[model samples]
Target: MATSFIVVLLFIALVGYTRLAEAVSENPTASQIRFLLDEDAALRQKLHTRIQGLRQSVSTLNASIVPCSCPLPTTPAPRTQVSYTGTLKSTMSSLNAASVFNFTGDLINVGAPYTPHDAHFVAPVSGIYGFSLAAYMSPRYYVYIDLLKENAPILHVKTGHYYSGSTNRQVNLGTNFVLTNMTKGDHVWAKYSGGSAYLFGEGVSTFSGFLLYEL
Candidate 1:
């Protein structure tokens, strides 16, 4: 009977100890709760500071951005300048009068207004133009070449015949230059208006022109 009472007391003490442990576990200590609350407040402050810094960085970047002030690209105006020079590569063998002297060799053909196919320079723009003709003829023959505008003679150069046994049987050279107003698409060329001769080539015969000023 004394042993039974002792067992009952021991069981009651065990139950009390278990209940105390459960209460301690379920209810955190005041120091621990204070520490957790302090940690939460510190984390909130750090997050707020980080968010503010990010917003400030974004604002600074946006303020530093600059817009372009340069002009946009544009198409360039078509060049009105025109110039060309053509020469005969081979001699004209017994060429008839009233024929066009076709200069088949190109020395400088800027703007590409001159064509060897028709031996004519079609003006690309309206302007005052200067035309030049430097021609050479064979010995004992005379040549009269005309710078013609639209098939109408505007300038002339003539080569004289060599005197017989006068020690001057050399080839003759004739050159002339003229300026005239020309409209766009007007044709210019050198024509053998009158000659009993052959046009000497090998770069000795040439026709050239250029735009002086646009009108």
Candidate 2:
């Protein structure tokens, strides 16, 4: 009860008219009362305007923000499933882009339609994604397998002899990304790190695989 009374008193003091009453003398002149009343009204207006402005600012801030309590998919996903595969007998030239059409690879083994480093795959599910890559480089060669969406590169790996004999390494695509961001018909593929290096799988090795997620 005491706390409630104190709160009510505080609220009363915040009002300009009540504050003026507190400042009034027991025997105040009429002119003094008028001037004090005007001042109180002015102060009240200022306080009211300030409160309104603060409310507007808060509303604007809330309007610009979006809350996400659930999972979000990665943007511009690779593909649902590769409808095509192109082999690379040679490295992809600077001007070459593999697939905008069938959404597949040039070939599982050869390097022609696109570059040799990457193989293409399509999305099979709609959810979050965790991608991993595994491949072996020949004793004297180097190879890199990178996942790509449309033309952008996603997950990638590098190994060769400079330090030859390295078989497989798995890399994270960062937890922030999800496979569901990829549309059902999006295109995804791997691009070669370099072309001239010796490759054991070349156009045929199935050392690499891609995975899609949902949830």
Which ten-residue region of model 1 has the weakest summed lDDT? Answer: 1-10
lDDT of each: 0.78, 0.47
The total of clashing pairs for model 2 equals: 35
Worst 10 residues of 2 by lDDT: 171-180
Q: Tens digits of per-residue lDDT for model 2 on 3-111? A: 4544554466477566566677676789879988787677667656656676777789889998988878768864443222433332222322332112233334221
After superposition, which runs of candidate 1 have C-alpha atoms over 4 Å from their true positions?
1-78, 162-171
Candidate 1, residues 1-215, lDDT tens digits: the string is 43454456556656655565566567779875666556556655755665667677778988999998999999987668788887889877666655667776856888888887778988999989999998887667777788889978989998857655756654488899999999999999887776675778888788999999888
